[model samples]
Target: MRRHRRAKIVATVGPASAAPDKLRALFLAGVDTFRLNFSHGLQEDHARVHAAIRALEQEVGRPIGILQDLQGPKIRIGTVKDGRLDLTAGETVRFVLDGSEGDKQAIPLCHPEIFAAAAPGQDLLIDDGRIRVRVVGLDADTLTAEVITGGPVSNRKGVNLPGTLLDLSPLTPKDRADLAFGLELGVDWVALSFVQKPSDVVEARALIGNRAGILSKIEKPQALERIGDIIRLSDAVMVARGDLGVEIPHEDVPGRQKELIRACRLAAKPVVVATQMLDSMVAAPAPTRAEASDVATAIYDGADAVMLSAESATGQYPVEAVTMMDRIIRSVEGHKLYRSIIATSDPGEEETPPHAVASATATLAEAVQASAIVTYTTSGTTTARVARKRPAVPILALTPHLATARRLCLMWGAHSVHTDDVDSYEEMTTKAADCAVQEEFARSSDLIVTTAGIPFQMAGNTNNIRVIQIQ
Candidate 1:
């Protein structure tokens, strides 16, 4: 199906929307990708959902993307006295590397990485920053801190060390197992969480090995410090604002989101703005105005996709949430100021032949008011480059590889079609025009722009651009 909006929607599948009929409804409501969160549900649950999605894909005759989001290392305090502890602002709390339950005087924090990496004056936020503490002293096995913001600390509350970089892998043992299961299920995208450095992405890439697209979730402050390297290494990026807001100043998130989006655009990689796009929709039928504005802002910033977490996973109105997001994107893109805003924020083309050709194709298509920009892509690179320009016309990406078509579902403005590989220029032109007509992207006598590499079926060699008029 051809989406009216350029930006895509990613919906998480859970108990609320796990049935085949619900999945199909979500897809029809404009969900381009489905996210399977390993943080919850069993492997068998995900397998069933995966099977249903594949069936839906065949039924609709469209490529649908599936993203497996790994639950990375989670550091949390051990059991507390009476299941909770009430702390005062000036009270001193002692945290020890023990598994035994204790009172406020000696709270057990089982994670050793936090104790080893934490230093005096570094802040420790618990329960999503509801209770804050700053370390004042530390020993080999214990960390003493005074409460900066006092609150009721409960058992197993999550810990966030914004100022310290723990020597830990983003992929936990469970994540590795989950990754294996997802790869076996043939997922199109793998979202690596808790990415603190570039090495985290490298480690994931080693296991992924081109089987799936590696998307790094930028939710840690340390990741932002080395974002350039992280973005360069990963196939795509996600502005994970939920945990990110807890780690950094809430005011800094919008600027960081824009920076990450621009960086991904420069690299011609897909970027998703995730976490609570329509949070209130989890309970309410419609989203709050602020939530709608939030989704529009991401689209205006040129985000490739906006995602729904709990809003679609366990929400009361999962299909309505996707429909609302789709409507918001269409409205924002149709606004008179959108084109100018996107043009102003353009990262421009890189100094490469492929990039030059892609940029020229976009420019020429707009100059001629072409009906569509048809791209003959083997590795989806040529289509991605054209999408990065955010052209006015639609983009029809024809590729022989179904994986390429599925991966391109997350890219902005690219409607992917899995077609047979063309061997010559004549075949390429004929196939592009035929697919455009078949896909309802063009009609007889309509002008269209086509781009491809000279060597057929070779990846990343976009050195040719052609303008054709359908007969």
Candidate 2:
């Protein structure tokens, strides 16, 4: 199916929408990618979903991106006494390594690394910042903290320390196993959660290597300090605002989101703005006005894609949520101001081969008013570069590698199609133009611009650009 707008949509798979037909409906509803949350289902369950997605890809004759989100390090308070305990302001609570049920005096914190790295005066926020405490002291066996914003602390509630950089890797044992499964399934993208430094990306990259794209989920406060380096190191970035909002104030999320989108755009990296875009649809058939506005805001801000988490995973109206989001994106993009807003962020002044070719493609397409810009890619880099320009026309990325086409789904204005390798320039144009026509992006006699390397056998050698009119 064809999308009218530039930005893409990501629908998460869960029990609510796991059927083969249901997933196919989601793809028809404009879901460019499917996110399998490892935090929820079993390996077997995700394997089923993965197989189902590949089946749909074959049936529809398209490249559908599969993103496996890893459940990163788990920092939480252990079991609480009486099932839960309430702490009052001015009261001190002890977090011990030994798991035990206790009263208001001490709670269980089994993670020894947290106690080791945690220092005095560091604030600890639990349950998404509902209960706040400040680490007053730390010893070999315990972490003494004072209740600053007291509330009910339950068993295994998430702990967020915005101050200190906890000594932890972005992956766990479960994540390692999940990574293996995802790679084996030919997953397109692997989202690393709770990324702190560039090393996190390096660590995950070392394991994933060239098998998949590493998308750093920026949700930790430490990540913000070195966001540029992380973006440079990562293949892509996702503004995972769910945890980010907890680590920082709600007011700061919007600014951070804008900053990240702009940074990624400048760096020519695909970025996804995720978390609660259409949250109300989880229960209601229609989204709240605020949620609708939120989706529009991401589109107008030039995000590559807006994600639907629980809304599509377990919502009462999964199809409606995606349809509504699609409508919102088209409506906002249809506005006369859409291109003007996007034009304000001009392409950078870089003379690199990729940048130069991408810039020329955009300029040439605009000059001729080409029906579309056709890109033959093997690693999705050329498509990403062209997307950063935000051309007025749609970008048709034709890739021989299914994974490359699938990974391009998260880029703005890119419509990916899997096609055979082009042995010559003549064959490349003919195949790309044919795929475009089949995709209904352009009709006969329509003007189009095609880009690729001279030696079709070589990669990243995009030194050629041509304009063609369909016969």
Candidate 3:
């Protein structure tokens, strides 16, 4: 199905939607990108999903982007003999690095990296911030914390150390293995989780080494302090709000999401707003009114894509969740407020000559009422520049590289197609106009604005723009 809206949808694949038929249905429903969450499923599970996506892409004649999200350093408490501990508030709990029985006295908290960084007065959020603990004392290989708010503390519950930047590599051993597996599987994007600073991104980039696009998942409060540096360093960014809400106050998530999206747009990097967008749809066929409004808010804030986590991955109503999210996005995009939001949003920092030239293509297209803005690019930056413009018209991005075409699925307002390299300017214009007509984005004699570099093979050399009539 053809989507009129520019913003994309990313749906996570899991047991509920791993079948080939279900995946195909989701693709036809409006899932522009498929996310293989590396946290849950096994390598074989992802292989099946990846194969299904490839088959669907072949059948649909469109490029689909697969994002493999690496599970970073996830710290959790060790298990007890009786399986659970009901600790009272204002009681002391000993977090020792030993395989001892976990009772009211002390449990095994084996992550020494966190303990090394532990200090007095630091808050330790356990089990998604459900249980709050404050560090009172630190000894050799042990941390004594006072339970500020206590509940049933179970085994393997997650631990979040807010306001404390631990000296830990973002990628654990599992993440490295998963990254190698995902690269072998040929995924388009790799999302690094829990990035705290620019150095984290640089380290991950060194490992990724241009094999795929590296997307930084912003879930830690420390990442926000250096967000601009992170945004500029990574190819894309994901506003991973699940842990972000835990790290920061719940009331601050909305503003932080907007800030991150704006930062990505300023750098022309695609940003995805993720986690609990349509939470109610996980169990019910319809989403709550608040859920609908939440999604609309993301779209209005000019995010390139909105993601569904449990709502699509393991929900009882996976298809229904995807359908509802698709409808909500379409409805919001068609609203009068959507265009006003795009028009009033930041115009982006156009630094280079190609950038300035690409920015003008939008205004010219709107003035002339062109059917589409056609971009012939080598590195996909030209189309990304146009996408940030949020023109009233659609963008047709033609590239010779299949990887570029697949990665463009995350871009707002970009419809990328793989084609042969253009030898001259005339070939570029012809391909752009032909694609506009063939794709039915425009008709005969319809005006099309085409932009590309002079030497077609050279990357980041977009320096020309032309208005052509489709023959």
Candidate 4:
């Protein structure tokens, strides 16, 4: 099937939309990909979803991508004895790491690493900031805290420490197991949540190997601090606005989203803007006007995909949400500004090697009226940079890395092909032309634009460019 919308729609699956029939309906409603949140679903549930997606792909006669989102190191308070507690502002609370358990006055802190890392005066947000506390004292057995802001605290509530760095690894055992399971299922993409540094991507890649593409969720401020490195290392990126909005100032999210998208575009890595795109649809059949504008903005900003969180997974109007997002993307893409926004570039004064090559390729594509632009990328940087230019013709990205292929599935106007990396420029150009013809992106006589580097450098080392006729 030909994609009608420039920006893809990624719908999450949950109890409300997990059935095969419902999944089929969603696929028909214009959901290009299905997201399986490993955090909530069991292994059996994932298997069922996987089977359903495969069945639908066959029925629809189109490749439908499946993204398995791994729940990385999720920090939460242990179970509360009473199931719920009310804390008044300025009230002192004590969190003890004692395994003894059970208490009406205090909650058990099972994460000793958290206690060791937290310092006095640091802020702790519990349950998405429903309850806020400040560390008052630290001890061997207990850590004292005072309620800075009061609200209802429930069992196993999530804990967020913004400034306080935790002394825990990014990937938990559960995430590792989930990665293996996702690979076994042949999932197209695996999204790693709460990625803090570039090393997280490296580790996940080592485990996943080439089984699937890794899409790092940029929800932590630490990730933003190391975004350039993370983008360089990751296959793709997701601007996970849910936790990100909570971690950083709410006003900063828009700028951060734009910055991340721009960076990914320059690197040619596909970026997805996720979370709460049509949240109101969880209850209502339609989205709010603001939500509609939000989705449109992402499309205009040249995001590869706009993701639906609970709106599609557990909302009553899952199908409607996907349909709405598809409509909005199509409508916005029709505008001249949409393409203009994507093609616009901010080439720094002293251009980096990747940037210089990307700019040259874009210029050559425009000048030659190329039937297609073929990019050889290892880490997806060159592909993303070329995509940001938004050439009128198709962009065929050939990567030896399967992770890059799956991750590029979300990119606007990009068709990723998995192939072996060539050692020389001539081999790279010939192979790229062959791929373009095989994919029907270019005819035998059509001109094609190709980009790569000499001496067979790493994935992002795109320092050469050529225009060749397909034969």
Candidate 5:
């Protein structure tokens, strides 16, 4: 289907939208990619969803993207006495490193990594920061902390230690297994959660290789410290704002979001703004005004895509949420100030032949008011570069590789078509014109800008651009 807007929508699959018919409805409603969250479901459940998506792709005659989200290390307090404990503000509490049940005196914290990394004076946020505590003292067996914010500390509530860098790999044994399964299932993208350093991405890259794109989730405070290196190492990035908000100050999230989007644009990598974009849609048919503004803000900042988590997963209005997100993007892109705003934030091209050609292609397309900017790609580099420019016209990416086409679905303004390889200049232009017409990108006599490599099918060799008028 042709999307009037440039930004894409990624929807998570869950019980609310896991049926084949529901999946098809979501695709028709404007979902560009499907994210399978491994944190909540069984392996069999995810496998079923993956199979259904592939089946839907075949039926629609379009390349659909599948993203496997690995559940990283989960740190939480062990079971509490009577399943709950309340610590009032300013009260002293002790967290012991044992698996036994706990009371107001000694709560069980089973993870030793937190103890090893944590120290006096650092704040410990529990249960999504509802219950805050400041570390007063620590020993090999226990951490003595004073409750900063009083609240009930439930059994196994998640623990967040802001500013403390734990010596742990983002990947757990479960994540490794999930990664292997996703790779075997032919997912287009793998999103690694809890990424703290560049080495975390490197470790995932070692396992992923060229099988799928590695998308780092920038939800850790440590990740923000080395974002540039992390972005350089990752194929793509996601602003997972849920856990991110808990780990960092909420006021700083917006600035960090803008910074990430700009960095990804400058690097020509896709970035997805996720979490609670339409959160209220989980129960209500329409989202709150602030939530609508949140989605629009990301589009205005030039995010490649905005994602739906519980809104599309277990929400009551999955299709409605997708439709609303689609409308929000179209509205933002059609705003009078959109063009100027995007251009203002545009990162100028790098000093290289490919970058120069890509930048020129966008400039030339706008200058000539072309119908579309068509790119021939094998590994999607040329298309990504063209998209980074955020050209006025839509990007029609023609690729012979289905994997490449599927992966490009996550990029901004990129409409990927799986076509046969073109061998020569004559054939390339002919195919470009044909696909443009068949895909309804342009009508007869309309002009289009086409880009490709000289060696024909070689990857990462973007060296040519031509403006062709449909016959």
Candidate 6:
């Protein structure tokens, strides 16, 4: 369904709200996209949510996007000997990866690769950094560590290496299976978690094969380092603040979040601000003023979407959370500064390739009074770049990736269409104009802004810009 506010709301579906009726209420409450966290629900449960979303789309007479978030490689300690281990500060604990039978003295570290790359003095955060430990010694099968902080560590507690580069891929075996299933279900978007580099995006895209758009979750510090490359590769970007906050300095997260949104906006990629927006709403009907301000800031920053995690998935007030988020977005969007904040960006020192193309498209769109701007993007980079310009017309993004289309749902003034890639710029523009007219998205008399590369090469190869009349 078409959202009234420029920024969109993305609600997670979980046990608290998965039924068709409940989902319909969420949609009515103003959820533009539905996020199915593969980390929690079963495939059958996801199928039900998918069906409900499709049904609701029909009922509402508008396309609703579905994002299937893959549970990426999550390294965790195996079952504890007594189901829980309490470590007192200054106590030494050993993390072993030996195939030896489970014992109370040493816990089985599922990821030995972590030890190979880890160094002494590196901090290891367990269970969301609840239990802090420092690497003391390294061995083939065991990592000796002294507990720096005392806490109860339970079964399958997650392990986080903040700065250390673990010798492990982002995708796990389970993620591959989930990706296959998501493709079979024809999901609109697939979110890859814990993305450390641009190569991760390429590998996932190769597997997805244009089935769905890829939204790389920028959570780890490594990801922040390679953001420009990742943005060039990924279809969209998600500021996953949960793990991000855990990985980086908490205070730095706010500035990083704004930076990411601006980067995506400059690239015209849809950026979603996710995690803990209404955390208190998980149990309370009302959100704290801080939470409201957090959401308003995202909207004010011109983020394409603000996401809810536990607030809607397992929260006591799922509907209310969505309602509140919707109200906050609407309120923030009403402010004249909202559009200005979204439009205002650091002026480019020079016209880069994508920036030059985007500036040209915006100028042409205004000059020709175009009804729409049609962007053909392979990795959705060119599309995002154009969107950053925030032209005074609808942007029709045509991509071969479904995930890109779904992700674009959150972008300002963007309407995504799934289409096969064109081999030539001429074909791409003509087809875009034809689709715009055929779908009644634009009229034959309407001028259309078109941008693409001459040869339709790699991602970020946006060099062409034109204004054409729809026929």
- Weakest lDDT window of 10 consecutive positions for candidate 5: 97-106
In the range 1-471, model 4's lDDT, one tens digit per residue, is: 456555778899999999999998888888877999999979989999999888886686556788999888888778776677888898888887864344534677788887888889988888887778999998877878999989888878888888555666667998878878888889988898889888888888888886777789999998888899999888789999988887788999999999998788766677899988999999999999999999988877878888998998889889999888888988998877766666564323226777777777878887889988888888666777777666666788888876566566677776777788688778888899888887777887899998875556475677888899877
Candidates' lDDT values, in order? Answer: 0.94, 0.88, 0.90, 0.82, 0.94, 0.82
Candidate 4, residue 439: CA error in Å? 8.6
The 10-residue segment of model 3 with minimum total lDDT is 97-106
RMSD versus native structure for model 4: 4.0
Residue-pair clashes per candidate, as listed?
A: 0, 0, 0, 6, 0, 8
Between the candidate structures 2 and 5, which one is better when assessed by lDDT?
5
Please report the TM-score between candidate 4 and the true structure: 0.84
Model 3 alpha-carbon drift over 4 Å, by segment: none
Using TM-score as the yardstick, the better of models 1 and 2 is 1
lDDT of 5 by residue, 1-471 (tens): 888889999999999999999999999999999999999899899999999999999999999999999989978998888898989999999999985789877899888998898889999999989999999999888999999999888888999999778888989999999999999999999999999999999999999999999999999999999999999999899999989999888999999999999999999999999999999999999999999999999999999999999999999999999999999999999999999999999977688889888989999998999999999999999999999999889999999999999999899999999999878888999999999999999998899999988888788889999999999
The order by descending lDDT is 1, 5, 3, 2, 6, 4
Global Cα lDDT for candidate 5? 0.94
Q: Estimate each model's TM-score.
A: 0.98, 0.97, 0.98, 0.84, 0.98, 0.83
lDDT of 2 by residue, 67-147 (tens): 999999968887877788988999988888886886665688788788877889999899999999999988988788889
lDDT of 2: 0.88
Provide the lDDT at 244 for model 1.
Answer: 96
Regions more than 4 Å wrong, model 6: 98-104, 346-385, 391-407, 415-471
Clashing pairs in 5: none
* TM-score pick, better of 1 and 6: 1
At residue 23, candidate 6 shows an lDDT of 93
Better of 2 and 5 by TM-score: 5
